[model samples]
Target: MLGSLLIANRGEIARRIIRTCRRLGIRTVAVYSEADAQAPFVREADQAVAIGPAPASESYLVGAKILEAALQSGAQAIHPGYGFLSENADFAEAVTAAGLIWVGPPPSSIRAMGLKDAAKKLMAEAGVPVTPGYMGDDQSEATLLAEAERIGFPVLIKAVAGGGGKGMRKVDAAKDFAAALTSCRREAKASFGDDHVLLETYATRPRHIEVQVFADSHGNAVHLYERDCSLQRRHQKVIEEAPAPGMTDEVREAVCQAAVRAALAVGYVGAGTIEFIADTTDGLKADRIWFMEMNTRLQVEHPVTEAITSQDLVEWQLRVASGEPLPLTQAEIPRRGHAIEARLYAENPHTGFLPSIGRLDHFRTPSDIRLDSAVEEGGVVTPFYDPMISKLIVHGPTRQAAAAKLAAACRAVEVYPVKTNAGFLARCLADPDFLSGAVDTGFIGERLASLLPPAEPSERVLQAAANEMVRRAGVPPALTGFRVNADPSFRVPLDHEGTRYTAQISPGAQPSALHVVVSGRDFIVFEDGEPYVLTLPRVEAGPEGSDGDGGVESSMPGLIIEVMVAVGDTVSKGAPLLVLEAMKMEHTLTAPFDGVVASLSVKKGDRVAEHVLLVKLDPSEVK
Candidate 1:
């Protein structure tokens, strides 16, 4: 085994590789950009090197700088964790030429599957079921339009290179095909440097199920069942599970075998994935699953596979890269219980799930299950990289148990300041269709209403607060002596979500009775309502930092992509104030609201940070 290795990537996956390297007695060298100097992944490595600026093109994607770092560190091997140049064929070849082991599939295999259109054609030749679509090389608009019409009405235009829902578009009718193709081609060219696209018939109800396959230099490969990545938003997976929820025994076997065949087709070695789109309406079948794509590196949801198989995939990658024979036969890989994973991101769900950045004031993770992360409480969630905070994974003997555990684990964990998708994830796991195992790729949008719990308080909660506050502070209590007076009325103050809720207190019951109503909720005062409601929402902590987490001024740095407000706009709390597009993702700024703009510091197309003043407002208007 190699004693030292260089990780040519950043973020959580890079940290994950370092962890496995440590366990295997391999020293790790981490490469980071200028903005990532203080990143958690950079600090966790045995040795670190500065590559370039914050932009990935000048930093992580700089193959020459990466090679220089590896050679300088005297590393014997390089591991490209999942993204950036992980699937770059030339990078793999360059590492080998430098006398360093490339801890991934061979360069030849990456070349074969790098392009979606070509890969589909190859799969068809290998007898692996592929989606019926146009895999031809003709890029003329006329030819493409003709193919789309012949294939069907609804189709998908996917980039030949790149993944992660980037450079992909869905066309529902011929009328929209031309515009979608243009947009898709532009994004593809920008994201992957290749505008080549392939059209595929859109599945009526698509379920993204992929099989994990491991192979060794000795040409031995085995399959590791499959994972269901059906639940997603904006083409990004939100939840994933192993031993797909509604798969049958026969179909599972056929799908697994097909994946094994696809892997072996290219003499594939190390950990790889063969993604398939399944039609569950008629149940699983050998003919029901179609080859979608292949991920040429360790997947983000690998922990789910590890939980079920009790095997370390990272170790397997190292072993395979060492030219060793398969460690275990196909029979040795057992299908155990169910496992599920949810990606927790530092983003907001209230407004189109825009990425949010801030200090993790109270970062807490659950210990009942496995958790993989690279950030900590004091770590800055900079817009220089992916906003994903961590991945929460859980295992249980049954699917129901796994769902239950995932829901509880998500809710039990707490993160302050930067809003996260944890609440959204918890709601998804507890969803009825998900629990019943009747899910599909369109689940998130199909059931958006019931799944999203309205951000409104219950009447009982308001009543309880009013009763408690009035009894606790007698300064604003009803003037009528409770025991002696027949009737009485009083007004009291309450606060909620940065808004004030004035309560009206009414005397009821025989003697010495108290009843209060706030926001149409009734509350009865017991023991003068002292203990129940200390202060009704307590809104007037004016001009003070009331952020739930430790008040950090700026969480990340990015360009002010757009500014929606100027001084003097009476916006509500939670309204979009502006947007910061960084790291290929958009982070939105929200108004503290109920205040007029006092000043403006930054405008659209300017650079800003967590502490930077884009806009200022008066705190008094909030009252």
Candidate 2:
């Protein structure tokens, strides 16, 4: 076994690797950027080193810095925990050249499967069924447009080097193809530094299924099982589960065998995942499944595979890198009950999933399940990294039981100041179609409104907040009016999201288990994983405070990537004004109402902080 290891990534994944290392008696060294200096993973490691500034380009993505950290800390192996440089073949080679073990697939495997277009061609050559698409070398716009037409109207434009739903777009009509292609290319260039893309036919009822395969230097490979990651938003996975709900024995064999073949074809070692796009319109048949791409490193959803197989994948990676043989044969690997994982992100579901950054103030998750978290109660969620704060994994005897347990766990999540998608996740698990195993990639988009929590606090939630407020004010719950004939309740004025409500606090009223947290003059009431931040109404504020002043402010700290409108531009409601890249995602700010752009303060490439006014709009006079 490797004596010591260096983790080259941050957040929950770093903590996850450290956990298995600790169990195996391996000393762990953590390399962090300035932004993550005080992160939970840094404090949990056996040793730590600061690499560079907060920007990933200057820190985590810099191979030389990471190599130096490992050398300085005397780490025998470097574990690229999934994201930054995990799949960078050059980085892997650099690590090996420095006489340090790279705890991942061989550099050759990464390079072979790094680009989607090339990987698909390679998979097809290896006799593995691949999705029908154009992976040709024609780079001109005319060729791409012609290819899209030939592939059919509904086609997917995917970046050759894309993953995690970035640099991908689906166009349904020929008229919208050009604009979509331009946007896709721009994003692809910004994300992967490569604007090359491939066209693929978009499945009407697509299901994302991936097989978890592991290999060793002894030329042995085996698959743990498969995971269904169909519950997605913006092409990114929202929930994942092991042993897909409708997978059959025969189909499982076919897919799993194909995955192993793909691994062996590239001489892959260590852990990797072969992602497939399945046409579920005809069920999970063998012929309907097609290879999409290969992830040459550990995946974010690997825990579900670990739970179902009763295997420590990180341990397996470590062993393989240490020149060990496969621990179990294909048939020897145990497969058990179902498991589900929900990614808890620090974002507001009410605001179209905008990333929310702030101090955690109060962070509490259920204790019974396995939780891999990045931030704790007092930790801050900076905008420099991914918004995912934790992942909640639950295992049960059956799929239904597992989904139920996961849903309950999501509802049990209690966070404050910073918003999260816990409530949205719980609702997704409880959705009738989801529970019935009828989900597709478009499930969330089809039922988004119903899945979101209520925009306003319910009557019960308001009452609970009022009760907590009264209790905190040192007033007894059973207190009655001083007048003989006076009513037994007093009105408490509360403001929630700029709306005022007068809650009649009845004396002796029983308080509900709404999980209320008191913060100064505000009471944050959590119900079903949705937080309702309520504050005591200010006596001097007026109704106008709720109205918008036509000033467009940055919701979070980010770099301006594009400005679509000028100062004199007349735009209607929902017209895109500019694009802000933050937290590894691009957000387009749109006009809130029909207005004329009166002022423009920021330009492309300008880095702005949260709440900085970027544009000012005036109501259109002609309207």
Which prediction has the highest lDDT against the true structure? Answer: 2
lDDT on C-alpha atoms for all candidate structures: 0.78, 0.88
RMSD of every candidate to native, in Å, equals: 14.0, 14.5
Off by over 4 Å in 2: 476-479, 539-623
Q: Give candidate 1's TM-score.
A: 0.77
Per-residue alpha-carbon lDDT of candidate 1 for residues 188-306, written as tens digits (9 for 90 to 100): 99988999999998988888999999989887899888999999887899999998987888888899999999998988989999999987667666787899999999999998999
lDDT of 1: 0.78
lDDT of 2 at 85: 96
Residue 538 of model 2 has an lDDT of 33
Q: For model 2, state the Cα shift of residue 496 in Å.
A: 1.3
Candidate 1 positional error at 393, Å: 0.3
Q: What's model 2's lDDT at 71? A: 98
- Residue 604, model 1: lDDT of 79
